[model samples]
Target: MIWTEINGKRGSIEIVSAIYIWIMKLPEAITHVTIYSDTCSGQNRNQYIAAFLLHLVHTHKTIKVIEQKYLESGNSFMEVDSMHSAIEKEKRFTEAYSIIDWKRIMQRARSNRHNKNVTPYNVTEFLYQDMIDVKALALMIIKNKTIAEDGETVHWFENKMSMI
Candidate 1:
């Protein structure tokens, strides 16, 4: 697992950057990944994020597949939220006025050592800005698209791509 603080509010750029950093640090043995993110259109649900996921599959031959999922807007009580709560609980007792402060708070959030590791993210290190226009590329390269019968969900897939 990987973690980090964003320079600003949680937006597409920040989310993409975080995911980019996390994937770059993943163990080479892992071949697949399923990312469950909140249904926030500005963040995970937009075309930009889809493009970022596609970029990952294109670049990393080891990762044969990557899936992105969104839970019902009001029904997100997954492991990620639990981890957020743990960090939030810790934040309540600390004075976090800078990026470093947040990192320290996250690092000290779990002292038990049994929880998944949390490493502070440096937003500057991952330059995802260059790929901001990936949404256009993704739209062009992804030709096979399927929509559920109900029309509530759509799926995109190929030899190394899948998203919903």
Candidate 2:
């Protein structure tokens, strides 16, 4: 949902913003949200993401739960991994100096003969108005009440990134 800003850091802050934008665009019928990602503290499994998820659960009327599940290391060969491999294979031959170039490379990766039938990724550039920061709000939440300690439940926990 967000990319291209000069200072853009694809950490929890930016990720949470992108996710917020995506979730806002979800259909009305969608309530439960389930996210499956590798147990990486930098991306999916982080306190900022957890805080943003908890914020969504409380603020969004249609959202009931935003579940975060970390896949086990050796057993997590998801389809997305194949896509990443393809993208990396494609990138090895070229040089990308900007986010747009990377986006284009990713778009072209799935268009090869073998995976021509694969759906193209929708990599929209971020608009000026789309830049958002949930950090302060997250901090406010943490100050008010600590994040949930139970990571196994439907709710997003505030226990630390390692636990997530």
In the order shown, the candidates' Cα RMSDs to the true structure are: 6.1, 4.6
Give the per-residue lDDT digits (tens) of candidate 2, residues 1-164: 43766656777767776788788889989988887767666777655676788878888989888777677778768787887898898899779998878988887777745465677666767754565676777687665343334533433333222221
Please give the distance, in angstroms, between residue 147's alpha carbon in candidate 2 and its true position after superposition.
Answer: 7.9
For model 1, state the Cα shift of residue 45 in Å. 0.7
Candidate 1 lDDT (Cα, 0 to 1): 0.64
> Where in model 2 is the C-alpha error above 4 Å?
1-5, 127-129, 144-164
Best by lDDT: 2
Clashing pairs in 1: 4-121
lDDT of 1 by residue, 33-132 (tens): 9888766777777656776787778878688788886776675578767667877888998998766677777666765453556444223433334224
lDDT of each: 0.64, 0.70
Alpha-carbon deviation at 29 in model 1, angstroms? 2.3
Error of 1 at 114 (Å): 11
